[model samples]
Target: MPDATASILLLGATGQVGHELRCTLAPLGAVHTPGRAAVDLRVPDAIRRAVDEIGPDLIVNAAAYTDVDGAEDAPRRAAAINAEAPRVLAEAAQTTGAWLVHYSTDYVFDGTKRAPYTEDDAPNPINVYSRTKRDGEAAIQAVGGRHVILRTSWMYSRRRSNFVRTMLRLADDTDRLTVVDDQLGVPTWAGWLAEATTTICNSLLGAEGASKAGCYHLAGTGQTSWYGFARAVFAQFGRTDVAVEPVSSDAYDTAAPRPAYTVLDSSRARAAFDLPATTWTAQLDRFCERIGTEKGTPKAPFASV
Candidate 1:
């Protein structure tokens, strides 16, 4: 029982999560998704105007300042989109009596814990980008609107520029690829996230009502390092010629600090809603199928990080 008549507004409709959101929400009611030209997040007034125009029953924010390295230099810009913009949407949703569905990242954790992080775990961000996301989550809660904040990790899709696509492209050129094996988390597919969102929204629309509306961990089933994920991807693509070597995080020096273990516990989401559990390898296989390999392997340039 899907709500095909509820007016909905989707922000950040071009990004990874937003792109999938568009496809998932298409069967639902009149969905409005605006890009920067149509609705700029920096300007709260623009978001207000869009909300007024759409008068949506639900507002899904899938956009954020996702450039981890860039955020180190431009923390203000990151805060504006990731933190302030979410507050603006929450405010607008509250004013319109619409449910706010927001997406967050696993970077909120400092990666000190050995076990998987739960929704109850306190967030301790290690970088500027993560700090902004933490601020956004707080702002959304402070706005006091009916909301569902989904914190996911290692998200990828065939359409966007993510780890999965990057690895696939690199495999075609290089014989050996070195990826950091220290950091661990689930590799979530954008389509899985989109479909999960649709299921929750539909449940909310039905007579049963929303059983739970708060922060929930939504990602793939198993946990693995970036190197392990790359190896799995290569396995699915049938490209054994290329060897994915594991390296330490110290090998890759960047402006932003990545979480070493941001794996989240998703038992809550599964119990609340009838969500399907799919492994990262399974999803990666499907993704590889979508983006076919090159005719012949190209000689790769060996560039060390």
Candidate 2:
């Protein structure tokens, strides 16, 4: 376990996972979350400066350029944040002797495998976003620092503008929802990720935990497609009146092509950290409960178009 007095430097404090990390890491140690004014990930020098200044015992990076389609138009911008920025952080961690905790995505895979992707699976990124992320992972490994890379998928939170929130908003404003069912992956809750990160951090900071430093899949247990996830979200809100149609990826025009399947096998993470597995439906239920309690009432059910 990490020392109770350890100082932690957390990047991307305003992001979905970052927002939750700030709260979850508090009990573990002092977490310094630098805003964009202090550390702009787009600027490599800023990241170096923040790392040097904080000189933390642990550095947890939760930031990334997550716009899959937007990345197709701006590959350089994506590389700067997803690849170059992480290289800088890893180097800093090496020099400062601080452990680095980084987050990755399941997009790194081509998703052709019939089963879930494991940590050892060779990455064959098909899109710019995934390629950049894959590069970032390689950079960290090449830096040879005490780091742990967590690969997750379909991340969502109540605060962020993610699929869950988008579906809720659409159900409130529209009637029919046509979602893509071809793509498949786990829908990981940011809250659960943050919590798991803390556990992983504690283990890494412990006496025998250093040897556990490597890549692992940290995501929700069960799997589902975009269409299935949308249906679950609507069901959570009692919005069965809405018609949810399943469509193939070819039905929609996009700048980038999504993977056909990217379900991650988190057995390594579970065995390593003794983390419990949770189904996507269970996680979604918890998320909905939180949203409902916060909002005080569910919006009207969506109707067929």
Candidate 3:
């Protein structure tokens, strides 16, 4: 639906991925990122009013309630943001004849399949957070508008509550870290995900992408367990000062039940968009290089750590 002078309405500008998206989407069109006060998703009326007012050719929704364990305690809030909100957005997109791009989670799968999960794999969400995401995907598809729902896993950034940042914090605060090795996924950098989304946005402006509209897996190329990912992070930084230990998922008493494996196969998105195949470890190298160049750390400066 995007033309040369396309108008883009991006939700969740404050988020890790959304923050990167604000700059990445600028070259494509005029990107409008309204704060929560203006586009409060919980208030459906506010969402419709914002969508109607903006009238964007492309609506990229990077926003969603992402607190996995927290969702166990507050399912209603999570559903409001993850399920009902996306449904309303899809309705608005259908009304305005705009293309909607929404993000989903790998947790939608029960993680029973040890192999990489494909797009066709049926979702059997085991937790409240994952269930809401699955509901959101269903609502969008039910609308039958031009949309692409990307299911990704293990998203991280320098400024977020993700595994990467958590490991960095642990590396600074302590030398001994015990991470779960049973749960497997691809640790995708938020910036890279933003760039990939930008590429998809460009392609979606054409005929080919329209035909490929559907749910697709778009995470990192390779996969590893949480313990392996953490070890890789430390290894990238050459953190000999720290020691990492691998344990089972049962080691931690989490509010939500974690799937044993949720690694997504991005082959569908790759074949559709002609995206390059890059591994998670290679991306980790790039991430570490970026952080090494930056001045400060999460708590104690990296220079000292």
Candidate 4:
């Protein structure tokens, strides 16, 4: 468990996982989440200055250039935030002897594997986003510091403009949706990721758990295609009027080539952290329940972003 007096510096506090981390890490220690204006990830000097100024015991980095399709056109920006920034942070953590917790994605793998990916699986990124994230993971490992890099997939949150929110927003007017069914992965909830991260961090802080520090596949249990995920979201919202059609990847024309199968095998994370696996459907139900309770109706659409 983390010491009560541990000072944690959290980057990307306003992002989906980062926002939830602020709440989950609160009871563990004091969490200082500086806005981008103070610790701009694009600038390496800014990152070094922030780490030096905060002098934190732990640094949880959740920020990244997450635009999968957009990265194809702007690879430099993605590399700056996802690759170089993490390298800088890892170096700083090495210097400070602080435990660094970083988030990665299943995109690191090319969807060629028949089964889910484990920590031992070699990464074969297919796009700019995945390549950059893979580079970040490598940089962190090369630093050889006390760090945990978690690779998750298809993350959605109530606040962010993610798959679930986008589906809800599109269902407002569209009656029929054509979703790709070829790509496969788990739809992880950001809140669940945050909570699991806290548990893992506590374990890492324990005496014997330091040896477990390494890259682990941390994601929601179960797997589904984009079409299946969209259907579940529509079902949760009781939007029977919106028809969801399953289509092959060939039908889509995205700038980036997403992996056809990237469902992460999180057995290592479960064994390491003693974390339970929750199915994606269960999480979706809970998210919908929260939305209903908060808005007093299940049909309350998120204001269009």
Candidate 5:
């Protein structure tokens, strides 16, 4: 357990998840978030130096190479940041005797499961990103540090380029949008992920038992295909003006082969922490409202095609 007033070191503070984490961790005492200027994950020495300097009681690694398709062409670069850096961070955390919190992804699975995947599911990553993340997870465990690994999927936010924003933009430009209907998974909001991390940290601090550490799935409540998700996004914008046509994955072949079924079983997280599950539609609603307010545009469901 951490001290009643513990200091935390947070990495990847500029990314979507990291952005929310920075804000959420403020209530925790002395939370230190290093920007890319201060600590670059690409530099192992920098990561080592930052950990040594901060000497925090807890280290939350929100940093990762999240470019799914881009990783295919740049496997070595992805491996360095996604796999090697976490290994260094875990080692540093162990040397400093601090608890570590790392993030993984659903891509770790091959997406062959008919239902949601459990933690025990053997990881058969089909892409470079997943393979590197799996290696990172192994490195974390091998380092023998007190840690918690969260495997989440389809993460997006109102602040960045994501499905929600894409749908909104395309809806404004075209009357018909084609999306892959075969790929299925839950869309996780970065805000929710950050809030959940905060909850878990609080739970860990309150307890006196052994360090509550293990891999768990954290995603939205239900499942939907990308096509279904797009339709919902359009609905939220009051935009019946556009039609979301369902297309097969083959039609939109890309660099990275996406898993057809990436929906993760979040039962363990919900049961363990009693974490509330947010629906996909509700998340889209919140995102639309937030983005609309930010752009000073009308939050209409849809505009005429």
Candidate 6:
């Protein structure tokens, strides 16, 4: 499957998933991660120039404005980075003969469906952030090039400022917590996504790479509500001191209305690339184990909250 030594341009190298990707994508090719000064995603001209200058065979875009509630206040900035930037990259990829690998969110769906959302489902973004991400997906598809759009849900890392970290911090500071129980989604480990992405990049260099270009639901297998996830996090981390109480989402007055359900069906991706599937709980357990070893937290079996 060695077509040629690929020159890869990886965007958003500092982000959670991006950081994991930086490690996993290293073996595939020469990865060049440009800083904001080198390539400003806010400016389309800067993005185009970066693509033109690097002339990469593969571009993995992990940069995104992920502040869901803050997006309501700064829609323009979100649109610039999440919406227009992808369109420019897709066009540049088409011109440079590079395969663009982009990450989107399962929030594109309204979350009303009881089952996992498939690639064919129409996007019904209910918030500004999700709208911008959904728009980005549409723009990339419209550009019509060798690209793969992977949509994941509830992605978290041991190092990032995510739910797992938040829960740990809360347990350290307080003994009681109120978490939303209505909303449902699958929590995906960042390392798993990075591994999947590397596999996809290798496939891209293979003969079947072009055929796999399109939208695919790439995410965790099992699903759980935010409340359940919080419980599991505290349980696995041996934070028995914290008493997490489940509450309705209506208890909080958030700017964005989170979808009630957003589980993603990653069956297509697994079948297409021969990827293995793992449950969110298993991923979380692995993550907790790492946290215990690295962060000096106590690790235990899955305990009920």
TM-score of each: 0.93, 0.95, 0.94, 0.96, 0.91, 0.95
Q: lDDT tens string, model 1, 162-205? A: 88678868777888899999999999888778988888877765
Flag the better candidate by TM-score, 2 or 5.
2
The lDDT of each candidate is 0.85, 0.88, 0.87, 0.89, 0.82, 0.89
Predicted structure with the largest TM-score when compared to the true one: 4
- Model 2 C-alpha lDDT per residue in residues 220-304, reported as the tens digit of each score: 7879999999888777777777899999999999999889999999999999999998887887777766544322345532222
Q: What overall lDDT, based on C-alpha atoms, would model 6 receive against the true structure? A: 0.89
- Candidate 3 or 1, higher lDDT: 3
lDDT of 5 at 184: 95
Give the winner by lDDT: 4
Question: Which parts of model 6 have CA positions greater than 4 angstroms off?
Answer: 1-4, 292-305
Better-scoring candidate (lDDT), 2 or 4: 4
Comparing 3 and 4 on TM-score, the stronger one: 4
Model 3 spans with C-alpha error above 4 angstroms:
1-4, 292-305
Model 5 TM-score is 0.91
lDDT of 2 at 99: 97
Enumerate clash totals for all models, in the order shown. 0, 0, 0, 0, 6, 0
- For each of the candidates, the C-alpha root-mean-square deviation to the true structure, in angstroms, is 3.8, 3.3, 2.8, 1.8, 3.6, 3.6
Clashing residue pairs in candidate 2 (N, C-alpha, C atoms within 3 angstroms) = none
Better structure of 1 and 6 per lDDT: 6
Instruction: Give a tens-digit lDDT track for model 4, residues 173-291.
Output: 78999999999999998888899999987877677766988999998788999999998887777778889999999998889998999999999999888999888887777766655
Residue pairs clashing, model 5: 237-300, 237-301, 238-301, 238-302, 239-301, 239-302
Shift in Å, residue 299, candidate 5:
3.2
Which portions of model 5 show Cα errors greater than 4 Å?
Answer: 1-4, 288-297, 300-305
